[model samples]
Target: MNLTQNRTRIIEVLIGILATQLIVFGLAIYMFNEPTRIVEAQGEILNVQLDDAMTLYAQNCSVCHGLAGEGIGATPALDSDALRTMDYNDLEKVIARGRFNTAMPAWSKEDGGPLSDYQISELVALIQSGDWIETQDRVVNLGLAPLIPFTTDPNPALLAEIGNLPDGATLQAAVQLFAANCVACHGADGLGTGIAPAVNDPLVREKTADELNRTVTLGSPGTLMAGWANVLTTEDINALVTLIQRWDEVPAGILPAPNVPIPVTEESLALGGQLFSQNCSRCHGPEGQGTQRAPALNVKSFLTDTSDLAIQQIVTQGVPGTAMPAWGDRMTESDIQAIVGFVRQWEPTAPEVATPTRGGGGGPPWLRNNTTTTQGTGQQSTTGQGQGQGQGQGQGQAAQTTTQPNWWEIIDWRILLLAIGALSIAFTLIFMGVESLKARARPAPTEDKSQE
Candidate 1:
């Protein structure tokens, strides 16, 4: 009878323990599982979108706008107070339609560019995110100037009088013309600025008035100097030349020429390629194919007509009254020569020519289109054979379509640790309950009283 009662007592205790566990498990599910699952799922989706956006930006936008959204040559900075304060819809429209008569191209696929609607939204989200906004705020507050100065439009009033200047124009008129049109690139005194070379340089002064006239009239092709023949009359061009020649009397320091001549070797060519990609590719296309902002260097006509000395001069002493900045201040003479060596390889008669990679260089691999070709028998193939090959190709293509698993597929380590801890606690309580029940069921040490 006592055994029967003890068995019932143990069963009841075990049931109560299980009931407590059930209640605790219910509470844990309510607290940690339901609410958190929704939030974690949403977070994973957001993270994936953000990653996609960053990749797209690097592939498409970074070339002109910089890797960090700071603008390059002639490109306005995206991460600025102006952009931050802009309405989201307006920003989206700019990315979709682009600015008129500017270097900024429409990026949306619908508008004839590569990106999709969803991708555009992701870029917008990225731009408006707190991190990017904070970066812009910091950059602005720091008052640091951009490496490449922004290009501004010449005054309309001044541009209208381009070909209408009077004969024997005075120095004051020339000064006003320089200030109104060329001051942004060339300095106020016609000395070099961040943008262009000094007009007072000895090499420039040495050029005869006729050579200067031709230069000013026809402009330098493949560089930023636009021909003033259409814009200025012959008299105006002559006056401009006269004013530039007068600078020779000022006795300013002359810019140095390259001490080390560039050697055209394989190693130099490779280094030149790297340097061009880092510096020139942003404005000029990756293979010098050209963009709306810069002229193509690889064109047959340009390569054929341009001379090595001319190329070297342009690289060293940038053209005045243009967006081309004087690179001599920033790069060593040897480095510039190395770049020149690389550029010369694109000449029309060169042994080998380079082709621009689609989407240009430094873009994501997925953006590149893969072309595959198959070999077949010279005789016409049977329909059955063709169908079989098509099926095999389809299967191979399907296999290639598999993508990497997203963050949501992976379990969180923190959640796993918490589950492990909870399980350990539950096991400990079960063991303790069993021990208590065993103690209750075990007979007391009454046998020790028999010894007494």
Candidate 2:
């Protein structure tokens, strides 16, 4: 072929390659703009157990792909047709090998991936039931399900046990006080660390008054988290419920969403219920009773005591200076109202809603866990895998064999795969275009002049 022909061919290939990009982007754009699909309230997808797969997705997938399989411009939808049409194994393959020529890269151990086959399989299985198609309300209705259903026997064991014991101040007041004074050391946000321990830690929130009392009375030495018994008043001591309730700020924290709105009528409540179960249920209990990591809503401390409007604000703004990050960007106003409605039903007798007791020269009943079995004294101890104390802290600090809870790891891999896949697709287009041009440029093999 002549040089002209080669150039012509190259131009055509380049055009085709560019067209492919337009096509991919066209399809991809729809996904970027569309909202995430929500699942049924009782659907296994959201209402299901927090297995290894779910955990992985939450940590990794939720970042760009979204918490409910919704995709952002950076990532594709995990629940919609883009993902649903693909078989579980196919998805697994994509995750493991990644789409070459695109940004998505292989994530398998064999392909330099982090997860094992088992973990991958678990992630795929969870995605199998993609109930993520349900449309979530920008707002939610806590009332759809009774905050505290009336039972014949009415065992308020969990509530009564943590309820009384003294703080008479308003829950909101405590929230302000703690935010102003305590957050600096205990993490103005609640997920404490380094200088401070995890004040908003799931287990720490559940400790009884006696436990808090003990920790508050005594001080944990060595650790920066000092005892604060002498400085604050008795009233301040009791305001901790506000802090305890907020401990559960995960999914980046569940205050409420802006796009999500509350549905008032039965229809709205039903809709809100559907939305909440899909997105909120993972952290808040399927029963809305509160998870180890999240606080329950129906409790008066966060409910009856505060106006519905305040709840809406919480949903939107999130408790600043707490683990509760804002969700306003996630939902619509209506959806936020609906979630408020949902919380109205979540009255767990009155939530103590106290913040974590920080600034302590003393260890209160709240900080029972600060001490390990090795020391009779109440001091901070880091136990990684429940493998006895003494050396526990040492090993944890050294290696942290502890993985990022399966779910978080999987999500991270998925993001890496998507990024690599995109890059691969881009390079593939350029390479194919270049090769076509090169092929066209080669002139027909010169006749053997020797024969002439």
Candidate 3:
């Protein structure tokens, strides 16, 4: 019995020691991973912010700033090293309040613009990251065309001749500026439209720089030509004047193509859903249910009355004097078509949305999983073996796939540690109880007194 008891005590001590080692190992792992986990969490948060900021940029800033923050026309590039290294507060303030007497509008809600303080902060962080390539990638994935970089160099002789220009203004700058702001009304190459006279005409070329500048700055009364004095800087006016005076010298400017009907396909619809969520969802709502900012596009009335072409037109040209800004410059014609197609899909069984609600509630931007939600059915169907085949509820189609979650990824380490500790204790107690029962069942070992 003494021998048996000694053996049992040894086994219990070994088990206890094993349990302690396991607990120590778990603690070590937790301690080592805590900093890593914090970093991962922070990275995930930044990624979400970046995604939101990317969408906001594509919708609001990309029109003038360019898709990759490479700058368009007179708009300054945000992808510069200087900008990335700029003070956060200064950058945030600039984004919120905008620059004085420039095209940059005050974006903060406090300043009567669309974005909130939190949104601006996200944008600031995104800009500071200098991840324009990622931004461009996301934009392209959303079906928008990538911004074409200007590879054409300006003639130095023309630069010398055109004095009193903006600090960084060049002949190329004039061409880009014209293409961006002038193409709609003035026609390509200043060919003129019914509403506006041709600035590239020989008669106009005969005018002096000062004369052209005056005409550009001040409005032609009772004419469609509005004064740009309030809108454009004096230097910008000079660049336009120079272009008009030297039209033959200026290189041919390419304008955005007119909208063409895009054939609706599953692929296009999927792409369209993504585009709408990224670009239109903030105002139009995720399901197009409308919000305080924009009207519900998924309603029976709106969808029925509005043709696909009409929707495309509205999306392209945008409604003037309202919150809508023209997307023709920012988005490709095909991209607009896809969005229109997606909107048109709702017409078949469009629901009447009487009340407007706040948009955006699918899941955390970083928590993308292969989970598809069937439309009109409260069923979730996951397709494909990997993570790419899921139809995200409000996220449209999945753009990319993620790795499958491992056991470690799925479980909370702390809980697992607690469970391990509890099991160890329970196991010890159970083993001791079993041993006690066996000891109780065994008759007391009687001392054999045969030798005595």
For each predicted model, how many residue pairs clash, with residues at least 3 apart or on different chains? 0, 110, 0
What does candidate 3's lDDT look like per residue over 1-452, in tens digits?
Answer: 77567656866786777678677767866875776566566666666677678766755565457767888667799898898899999999998877766556677777656678998998998898736766664443343332222222334454454444443345557766776566544655575532246777889899999888877776454333545766788887887888888776643433322333334545456656776776887887677777889988877888767666568768988999999889876865556765777777767656654345654565222222112231231111111111122222333112112212333663576557667776776777677677666655553444334334
Q: lDDT tens string, model 1, 33-52?
A: 65556656665565555555
Which TM-score value belongs to model 2?
Answer: 0.24
TM-score of each: 0.33, 0.24, 0.41
lDDT of 1 at 436: 69
The worst-scoring run of ten residues by lDDT in candidate 3 lies at 377-386
lDDT of 2 by residue, 1-452 (tens): 46656677667776776677667655564443332222222232333322334444533343335435665444566676656567777888987765654334355667655567776676665566433322111101112111111111112242232234343234445544444444433443344412345566778878876676555433353222334455455666666544455445322221121232233544334445655665665665454545555776534455646766567677778878866668777765445555566556545433455332232233223321111122221121111111112121222222222322343433554455556557766886777667766665453344444345
Name the best candidate (by lDDT): 3
By TM-score, who's the top model here?
A: 3
By TM-score, is 1 or 2 better?
A: 1
Error of 1 at 260 (Å): 20
Which regions in candidate 3 have their CA more than 4 angstroms from the true location? 1-19, 32-36, 137-452
Error of 2 at 29 (Å): 57
